[model samples]
Target: MFAKSTNEKPESIKRVEKVTGRLVIFYEVDICNKSELHKIFKLHKIDCVIHLAAFKYVGESVKTPLAYYVNNISTSLVLLEVMQECRVKKLIFSSSSNVYGNPKFLPVTEDHCTGQNCTNPYGRSKYFVEEILKDVCTSDPDWRVILLRYFAPSGAHRSGLIGEDPLSEHLNLIPCIAQVAAGQRTKIKIFGQDYNTRDGTCIRDYTHVTDIADGHVKALKKISEDLFKGWTAYNLAAGKGYTVLEIIKIFEKVAKRNIKYELFDRRTVGRSWQDDDLKTVKTTKVVGKRYIVLHAGNKNGFIPGADLVFSSSTKNSDYHGEMNQAAKLQNVQTLLEAHFGKEWAQHDNLEWYKNILKGLKDSENENSQDQEYEEEECNSLEDEIAIHI
Candidate 1:
């Protein structure tokens, strides 16, 4: 439910419907807008919501921590508040393997410690939402929620109608390698090669996008059942890990060309980290009574503060000035406690934010379009883009 953002390229809502043959209703509205979201709940009877929206880039989160928190966390809170008023309680939140942070073991589990090792604002924001959801389920028995934490989402559907189409060609490994193969880019910039693994490239659990979608469908169906309640999370992954060089070799064989790449120092690619070498890295900046999370990572994997704050991550001035936006972050939680002190804990704002994020876009976009289809009282479809290959 978005059509505005300097940094966001939200996939068209109509295009996904056309390819999948599913009845769809779309609204080009930002989730940050409270009234727009509430309008949706007033118009429909949404049973379940699969929230798959967020500002996902990890490096960008470091440069602009406040934007990430506001968009990913605060915006979610607003959505949850609206959903509760409408009494639509079932939710499926799109979480990430990045929330697992540096892997303490080979195969990461849902029970493995979270929020502790999160290295970036993007990951930290996800962790924060998960914690919020857990608290929500605790306070309310009616809430049924499932948090699906996934790794590298790759491959396409069997129909070949929809697939991964990144806004930036170099954003992810599969897309970046494809750009190099298709001659859209000069060479792939391999983040690092000094890891304690074979070929030294990063190792990750690459699952098909269809499987990830299927996982969500399964969770939705499960939660819809009477027996399901509270919060449960699972790792939607292949369990086996593939190194970057291994993936490139497969691409080389298929494309019949040597994909050239330049090696840089180890940097956190965010997800696709399950190896032993990766550890929690935090960059802290103290500003008066408030402390801003400047960067999150280890010596090898974290983005240098010099490159993050003063320099550009996207090479565009608008995207380059993320740090500038970060300076204006509102520490709502801290400030609320500072003035209201312990009285703040009794407020329902925490509960409101938790449940709202899970169904924010779905409730708001129910009748966003002029010619939206007839659903009696149902809001349909999430906005997504498709690829042809």
Candidate 2:
């Protein structure tokens, strides 16, 4: 219930606060702020922490590599240090399958080597944090760690009371398809249609957010019961892979609408820093209560956030040194609106621009670029989102 952005969907927080009363404390505080973060930790008798915070977003990470490293890695370190001070011993980390990169084997297992071929900066950041956790576990057998390396998560809650409210600019498959059905855009663009998989598109294991949450509770109980020490990794996915087209078809059938789409060879675009999972919520089912968990083709792999925070990450600082988040967002939307009709661009632009990186904010990386946009004619929202994939 702690967050920095007072503007990142205030209504959702309001709704939660309304029901929880004083049981759920909401703090609009930044974790990077040692003093503020510590103050909150002091208030609660926290024993175990779920470390799910980090900067994500593949293309943006590539554009701002250092931002990814500092936000994803440094912030986790800071949280850990605070946990140690507060005597929080057990931690469940929200890791990502991106650690496996372009998987060598189907249904990637926990043993798959990571950080070796991570092309995306976001993936590397997660891999590095996993390493840090391993070091922490090895250094102190008292520290119990469980790394949940989950695949792409989708679906919403069953109650439909609280659902995902992702910024309009970037969305996962379901939301994007939803947009198309609503006529937000013309078509869906499949990232790749010629992969080795049967459907030719990249195959990803998707699980419902509810299943993932239940799995964590199970993991916590398991860890407590066994007194397990050190590090253990588990894949929390519906041990099944679905092609982009397969998902589109399902949505189309359910919605009873023709989701216009176009298959593209690839895309070349630019985008920056997205943050974490300790306090992250996976993607919620689009609507209602009771998210029916997808039964995976592999029963063994079946597994499973509001925030759609693949990794519960936060940039320690704005890194870009831009205090005018409101102004910057106006610029991005003004720019996107020109290309993507008015409704085409609606996500809160400054959603990810919070906290300050301190020393790194002033320093510039060689790969970093100014707010620049390369324009190409795009008809569908899919083209806008998938072009950069």
Candidate 3:
């Protein structure tokens, strides 16, 4: 498979090579460099392209709007020009639900209006690209494109060899929570807790990364079919929504640990990034077997890897601890001793322990509350989540 490596230290790509024992032909060139990207396309005799390069962080995008526009939009424009020149018209563009902005309705569909109310430049970039692709398709019937608007994609590959390993501070919810559970961070900073949702936290639909990958394969297959002529869009999501606090409780269950968190006044950019009206979606029909299933009570509807133990020898192993024993009581004493230098017993009754216990109790009460209306709304979109190109 052809890919692009932008990071100087592309450790994940190297790990892919090591584990699979297969050569991945990739170029480290920037996608905005049309000549270089064109050469790669011509050299490979490329027939199709999957455009996923973009500056995606919402807060970062708000901080630097020009960078987001230049990188995200420029790369797509360059890639499209090269594709047209190479006569490689088949393309799958990774779009985002952010293009929908604050949802006017629950269970958003492909027909949901875009390019309006986009709260940040990142969302605007995706919307602009989609519009550009639409114009390209209109100008040439030979060009076919698929826009995959993804919700929150989380979790690791089932093999556990690859996962979300961000170089900078964690921006997504799942990774941030995992960092706390793994002791990499002392606590998770919840952006807001005063929204209008049932739990007063922003609700989002999260799908497994594997499922998101599967959606791409299905999109490619759909575009290759002769009947699939014009450009279309689909939402890749679990069709269920979860509050930040709910996810934390679920992660605690899966990780067998207490996740400490503190709430702060939400930033405008932060709210734009995640907080919104219930943002579940009824996905378009992709030509493939359904890969997503939602079990009762599990909002994410997938197995999470928070408790996964990694060997220290693995190149990507950032956090190491005993398997299935990460939060055992004995380990707590060990952790205290390590921190307090053998005088931990004297501070065993410290207020910190009481606060943690209190947090756990508060979390339990929050999770136990039922949002029947929201659950029903999400269930209404379950059957539609089945992908059929």
Number of the predicted model whose TM-score against the real structure is largest: 3
> TM-score of model 3 relative to the true fold?
0.67
lDDT tens digits, residues 123-168, model 2?
A: 8889989999999888888888889987777777676655566663
Query: Sort by lDDT, best first: what order?
Result: 3, 1, 2
- Give lDDT per model, in order: 0.65, 0.61, 0.70
Clashes within 3 Å, all models in order: 6, 43, 5
Q: Which consecutive 10 residues in model 2 have the weakest lDDT in total?
A: 269-278
* Residue-wise C-alpha lDDT for candidate 3, range 1-389, written one tens digit per residue: 44455433577777678767988776788787788877788678776788888877876787888999999988899888988988999999999999998665667788979977787888999999999999999999999999999998899977787887776652788988998999999998887665556676767798898899999989989999989997999999998888889999999999999999998655443332233443542221122222322222122332232122233332322211111122432344444445445533422222222333344442343432333433454555443321110
The positional error of residue 178 in candidate 1, measured at the CA in angstroms, is 1.0
RMSD of 2: 22.0
List the candidate 1 regions with Cα displacement exceeding 4 Å. Answer: 1-12, 269-389
TM-score of each: 0.67, 0.65, 0.67
Give the top-scoring candidate (lDDT): 3
Ranking by TM-score: 3, 1, 2
Q: Which ranges of candidate 3 are over 4 A from the true structure?
A: 1-9, 17-22, 269-389
Candidate 2's C-alpha runs over 4 A off are 6-8, 14-22, 267-389
Q: Cα lDDT of model 1 overall?
A: 0.65
